[model samples]
Target: MMATAVVLDPAVTMRTPEWLFLSTGIRAVDHAVEDICSVTGNVFSEGASMQALRLLSRGLLGAKARPEDPAPRLDCLTGAWMSMVGSQSGVEKGASHGIGHALGGTAGMPHGYTSCVMLPVVLRYNQPVNAAQQAMVSEALGQPGTPAADLVAGLVAELGLPGRLRDCGVKREQLDMIAEAAMHDRWIPTNPRPLDLAGVRALLEEAW
Candidate 1:
């Protein structure tokens, strides 16, 4: 989910709030329950991904409030679609996803759950190199003043999602293996910041 939002072209301007309102209409229909409840499945330029993030944030918050509302549901779906626009256009997933792939494969965690646990930690770790981009992420999530990592953590909490590596049965000892495996992931090269085994270890430790 974070990968989806992080990969868009930041140059594109989108009135995400407007889209949310237009899609939901005035029916008070509960699309949130209809959409967010479903499980599903990127990366690319920061510009497009930022717009997608804004859409996703609004959609998610709205859906959380009115799970049964169609407007927010539509917004969530569209936001999801937009999130992957970067990957489709030639962008790759970054460290958050690369590490997630490692966690899911080695730790036997679910793909969706991996993001819930790793994204916040990875975002914080990468902020030194991508503070501007991370700020856009915070804004898109509708918490411009908040740290992006904190906002992501809050979102996971609100969704009743797991927020810790330990919650998924990942052991402290497994951190080394996960980091090594993540170093080999294809997406690692695309991470906003250059990554090494030591960096990966630190990220895993934080997530754990």
Candidate 2:
């Protein structure tokens, strides 16, 4: 009921289709539409980000009940966070989230689970672009002493998330399409680096 209510809220209603479709087989243009619907329709920004962060903080640090699980809130909040992260870093479509979408769709893993697991890898991959940003991410995760990239990996392990795409039931052959689709995602603009289809494909292969 809580998730249903949350999804039906004006902020989230607009982005629902996009989240539903960016799967192992969905086309890139469709993914773009999803992103557009999400940002323009819901128009989540700084305010939404703050609310989400508050909810997330309470969920992660203050409570363990179903209401505070963080998973449902994450679907909306994390995307908003990434959009903000994209804005702040001047990088669009940043990191392993695209990869996580593919793996999550193919494996029945939730989006938050995918994000939690794959972000560390992307954070590491993008480290050369901004050590400071990565460090901030490390600190946010409460792993201040760990290397930014490795901190993500360590956090994923500690969180009991999937460590590899293969572990999530992704096939060897599907990596190409996943990478290709990810490259076309509008979020691509937020990435720290300009990832081509080939580059995304390579990352998929490596993750595979």
Badly placed stretches (over 4 Å) of model 1 are 1-47
Over 1-208, each residue of candidate 1 has an lDDT whose tens digit, in order, gives 3443443232232333532332222111111111111111022345555565666666666766765565655665566555545545555556777888898799897666777777777677767866766676676567787887788777777755678899878989989999999988987776767788998898888888
Q: Give the clash total for candidate 1.
A: 23
TM-score of each: 0.73, 0.57
- Clash count, predicted structure 2: 10
Q: How well does candidate 1 score on lDDT at residue 59?
A: 62
Off by over 4 Å in 2: 1-93, 104-109
Model 1 scores what on Cα lDDT?
0.61
- What is candidate 2's CA lDDT for residue 57? 35
| Model 2 per-residue lDDT tens digits across residues 1-208 | 1122223232433344433322211122112212222222233333343343333333332222333333544443443333343233332345555666666555566665556545555665666766654454445435566775575455345434565777767777887767766665666555666567777777666665
